[model samples]
Target chain A: MTNAAADTTPAIEAFNLTKVYGSGNTEVVAMKDVSLTVARGEVVALLGPSGAGKSTLLTAIGLINPPTAGRIVIGGQPVMEADHALVDLRAFRRQHLGFIFQKSNLIPFLSAVENVQVALEINDVLPRPARSRAMELLDYLGVADRANNLPDALSGGQQQRVAVARALANEPSLILADEPTAALDSERGRQVMELFRKVAHERGAAVMVVTHDHRSLDVFDRHFEMEDGRLKNGTERNIEQ
Target chain B: MNLATKDIRHNFGRFALTTVGIGLLLMIVMGMGGIYRGLIREATLLVEKIGADLWLVQGSTRGPFAEISRVPANLEDRARAVPGVAGARRFVSHTIQREHRGRPLRMVVQGLSWPEDRGAWIPLVAGRPLRQAHFETIADRSLGLPLGEKLKLGKDVYEVVGLTKGMVGSGGDGLCFFTVSDAVSIQFDVPGEGVRLERQARRARAEGQDIGRLQPLLLERAAGPASGIPALAPPQVSAVMVTLQPGADAAQVAATFATWPDIKVYSTQQQINLLLAGMVDKARRQLGLFRVLLIIISTIIMALIIYTLTLDKIHDIAMLKLMGARNGIIVGLILQQALLIGALGYGLAYWLGTFAFPKFPRLVVIETPDLLSLAAIVLGISVLSSLLGIWKAMSVEPNKVLS
Candidate 1:
């Protein structure tokens, strides 16, 4: 598929994705024939207990760990089929994908603006424009005032905001967030969840978040729960209150 | 903002400390090289400074430095008569230990055939060269002999007339110049008791033994020094130093002298090579070994430091890899850090060598080409040392960040 198809296609499509760890007697299936689709401007939540393969499915969709048997398309570009990368995954990921981890995972030495700018810089943006774009993203995320602060200097919520700004710096079509607000308090967590919702709605980017907290379910357009490495159908649960 | 510089700035104290440690090691390496150069300089200084085109010594021996060489003093005239030779002088060199104010001082006494020749070659720093032939001597300043001070050698006393700087033998001993007649007397003169014992022994051995014409010869040999026992055969010299006329080929003169059965002749260049390869070879090898060992130690230390630094940043490296940074970028970061450390260490070492080497007890000769070569070696070592860190960084799995 060409880039033109990306305009009208869903932001992510995974068909019968399978992931296996080890082999022979030690063989374990992490994900089994998982199929999922997320539309543009959609916010989705993945809920699961430990070892439920939520991380596995998340990593698989993030193009970090390719599935054993699967077909994945992101932004109308055929990215991976089975174990082979149909595209230059690293370059494709750099151009079309963004990630947010449980912790901010910011480069400790870089200031907030620099951390965000690094993402744009990796995408071949010049320093001046990348700096401006980083500042714009920081302002969009309400962390512009902390742009010069290093990650250590920022509060947990502020650091997460800066991380969000970093994820959006490249204008990626899809953002994969794995427990992005787990370390924050309930109010801070809700605020971060709402930020994800705003990002997906305002920027027309697909956002998938893996979280154990049910308090912010309403912030997502659809909810997913996993069990035994299998993804269940989405439930329209609105529990934002 | 270079990543390597940022990292170094982040841990400035530790980075500076490591650089200083490596700098000290490099300083020692450079000092060893300087000492080697100094040895070469001291070994060939007198040979070059003597201003002689060729050296004629006893056959079957390398002169002065390698073995004892003695030729008849009359050979000086024969060497001067050679086709290309402009002048020739009898040169006598011997080491002797003497007492000065209750302190023992070992000195190399050089005997010049013509006293006036001292002014032509020997560099006097404080006083005039030897003006009179009998008891006047020019001493190397390193001996601490004051001008006009009296020094006793054997039974004769001489006054120091001048002081020369850096006029040392191959063994680094200071040299004192005297007239050939005085040196020969001090070196070859036997004590009065030994002459009496030899005369008595000769009288006892000749009693009623030679019943023929040998009786006159035996009676004459029994005579003492006052009786002139063959006049002591004129005084032998260690070597004849020859100076060539303008445009004279030293090789041609040396070749002509080589045909003589009892004399070995060498050009000045050949003598320098002999000194360097023969006399200074062991010291040079020892210094070369030290330099090699220091280089190895430096390489190992740098490798360990870089490896430890890389290990400390494994988390950051994983994150970078996860963020789509290529292996080349990470490798470049480590290499840049290594090169920075090398440059800083070398700079510190160069500074230290410049200020510290002169204060050392021995001569340390630093040359520009040596420093340039050291820099190239340090760069090569930096690249080689960073390989360990580069390998570690490259092996870091991007998936490690997920954990």
Candidate 2:
């Protein structure tokens, strides 16, 4: 359902999403009737073991791999239903979604500032303003001093911080991250987790992170667990205020 | 920042090496084209310099360069008598090998009737024209003969009276100018021993025929000083060069000579075409085939370079896709890099050609139009070559970043 006002809209909503890997005797279901909803300003952790379909659910919601049967909405607009895309997925993704992967994956040829500015540029932002906004995001992410450095020149923690700056450069309403800190040390991972929390709380954006590290669970406002292509207990644990 | 430039800077050594490799190949392609142009220049050099409007040669031959064409020396006078004919000269040409400074030199000797005829003499680079009729010659500077030097040809020594530049025959041999009478003697005079033997045989035959009254008359006719052997007969000429009045139609005047029993007429343009299409046709075709093969090899090399570069950066491309970069952006990145490489290769080719062509054994004429067309072809090839990389980049699934 479409919300009447943007202020009251949920950041993400999905109903009965299912992803099947194959057909006939080799058929394997990766997501089973999964449903989820996250309000604006919410930070949620998707916790699961290997092969538990956390990545499948995350990729489906990220508009990368559409589910075989589902109704999905993002930022108050219906985006997909039953294997059909309701919008220009690439444009919509560019304008409304941000992704952070396990590796920084910064384009090696570009500096940190350029890496961040490119995201805005692809969204039709003028170069001058895009550059300023990139600097501002970098400043906010605590890696402003490293903006001119190449990815290889920066420390692991600094690279991830620059990646966060890039993800927020467009000020997207929703952010999806897959093991964003899997390569960082415990302290760097915790720092990256806290950065995501700050992004969600301060920017009023919804964040969904699929991660195996449980040490940073306290940073999430709500938590969900997945197992064997199913969400357990249909439960959502809200951190005590 | 431009993605193509940034990537190239990041991997400067590899990009430079690849560009240089392509540059060498492009240089070869352009060199082949230059050789073809050079052949055309050499083939038509004499025809252009002769300043003649028409050529009269033996009727059965194609022209002097394409085949043996010999017309009588008197044809020049007959050609001059034609109504629209402005002037005519007896032209004789033959290639001869002579020893010069211990090395054999092949020279194309051209005979001109008048020593003052500018149309017949090579463009003088040094010294004066042929001042003496029998033993003076103007030689092309390419022959390495200095002014006032004596050169022996067929038992006679001739002084080099003048020097000329760029005077070469269709076969790329340097040209030497001599008086028509001298050239005829040099080309056709029999040895003295052969002449003496002919005289003895005639006297023996006369003595063998013994009719009482007839014997005395025959002996007197054969032995008298008045009947002594005269000089060898005058030599024949190859062709006659004809000039036309300003208002005269060369084709029309040439047509008048068609009725002549043993001679054929040709316009200057026809002779040039004969030289090119008949004399240099095979060389042109072979050069064309080599150019085509080099182009094909350059394209394959470009495609492989771009494709391999793209493959090396699959992760980067996938990351760009994941970040919502449109397929167009990715395609542009690859295409721009390819074009840059093409430009670098073209620049290197032009530089190499400028310094290298002059040193080639044959003439190599590098013209502006050839370079412009080559640049266009290189650009087109770059675009075509980048297609494989574009396809590979576009097909990179954004979801691969997750895996």
Candidate 3:
């Protein structure tokens, strides 16, 4: 990750984000009047049950699905106001945001290293450096030996690690992951969760992970709980909700 | 970083088989064009090689090949006497089927004006032109005749004294060159029974009249054999081939012959046009229709294949968008594969055509300009075909990955 600047502004500040689907009688609120902030150099966990808007809020902050009503500021810049983009959303996403999904979601045709290198290439980085940076990320993630293998050839833990490497390829300020370790065993899941803590502390990237695994709650710097499309509680520093 | 090549490498076997299938289809399309071109070449081959500036045929007829035209052989002398005419030769052509080595053989027998034109202008692959002329023949290789092989045709046996290659008639039969007298004789030669019947009929007519009683010797001579009969004129030729001096105007000389009541005049190019317009026109349209249909089929197959490839990568495309890949990258991935298939298929077609075309009964003449045109056409098809896949890829929402 690029060095974090000495600014005190939070990495992400989302205000009264509301995402509604359909219209009139058929309207459904996926997220309603939700406000949250994730500071740089901190790892936060979003804990909720299914249909509690955890994923909806994650996608909203990731700039993939804009909230129907709200303001989103990332890295001290106003990015979206009520679904109207303040900047080119795709460029902004490439420069400042990263996402990890429930599945590894690596391009099946690309090798582990290429999966990471492609992310850099999408940001217009040259191949040689992209490859070099991909290698460093793979080495840091402890999957360097499996870098040349296709995603199908890697194990669940190894694939998730490669996905993490890819998400970190652009050195973004905010990293959002949705159930990234849901498919792993308890030991592997905790290990992946701890790796997020290391990344947040060492690289100074604000990390937000949506998960139902309360067993790894101690690894996060803070915890936010959601129910019925609203934040039920927000706790600081490894506190149980 | 090229997603197209990476995906192909991952599924090399399936991709290769698909390419081969498309390549074979493209080969047929390319071959159709070659066959049409070959037809044009075959239609104009004799006209171009005969080096005639003008042709004098029977009045109001399209002669020699396109339609039947028979003028007196004496037209050669009249054509030669025209102002600015450098030379004139008798042209006679007719198709005949005869038995050779117990197999039915078809050939277009063309007459060469003797002494003045001894088949010297014909392109020879082996042996010499008709030296003695009466029984010597110059045969095309397509006739399967070997040099020195003598075959009995009609009342005379003609020896294959020379060999030529790629000499085909407008009807797609092999061509054979013979002396004008021999050709005319072969055309009119009758069996012994036919001659006897013809002579008997003539004698019976004479006997029915009062002149038979006073002309018994005339009846006896006429009834003996047709060769002994003195009443018949010489056989007619199909046309008169004329060449002009270097500075002579062919249109002027043709106009002069056009004024003659007994003959029609045509330039060399006009004869070629008549053959193309009459003999080869329908076949050209048929082949052109088939080519267009095959191209359309190939385009549809390519579009479906690309769309399927994109469908297989739907999840990956969504993920790529989620990772901030631009629309250009996704579009490039599909477009590149389509273009690659077209380029590879075209290359395979050209390579296959080299050996396959020669084996066909009719010639397949593939020219350089046609190849270039086909390549451009294939490129256009590739681009058009890929739009389907590109549209599908572009519609994939990044949120789909999150879901």
Estimate how well candidate 3 is docked, as a DockQ score.
Answer: 0.77
B195-257, model 2: which lDDT tens digit per residue?
666666666767877752366766555543323534323457888989999899777898898
lDDT of 1 by residue, B1-403 (tens): 3568778877789899999999999999999999888888888887888888889989988886678888998998898788978889888888888688899888888887774375556778988877787888999988889999998887789999889987877777888989888888778767778868877776676564763236776566655453465645676898989989898876777789999999888878888888888868989998999899999999999999999999988877877776677667688889999999999999999998889998775678989999999999999999999999999999887667777
Cα lDDT of candidate 3 equals 0.91
Compared with the true structure, what per-residue lDDT tens digits does model 1 show for residues A74-188? 9777889998999877777778888899888888768899889878877778889999999998998899999998888999999999989988887788999999989999999
TM-score of chain B of 2: 0.88
Candidate 2 ranges beyond 4 A from true positions: A1-6, A233-241, B116-121, B181-233
Error of 3 at B397 (Å): 1.2
Best-first order by DockQ: 3, 2, 1
- Could you tell me which 10 consecutive residues in candidate 3 chain B have the lowest summed lDDT? B225-234
Who wins the TM-score comparison? 3
TM-score of chain A of 1: 0.95
Pairs of colliding residues, candidate 2: none
> What TM value does model 2 have?
0.91
C-alpha TM-scores of all predictions: 0.90, 0.91, 0.96
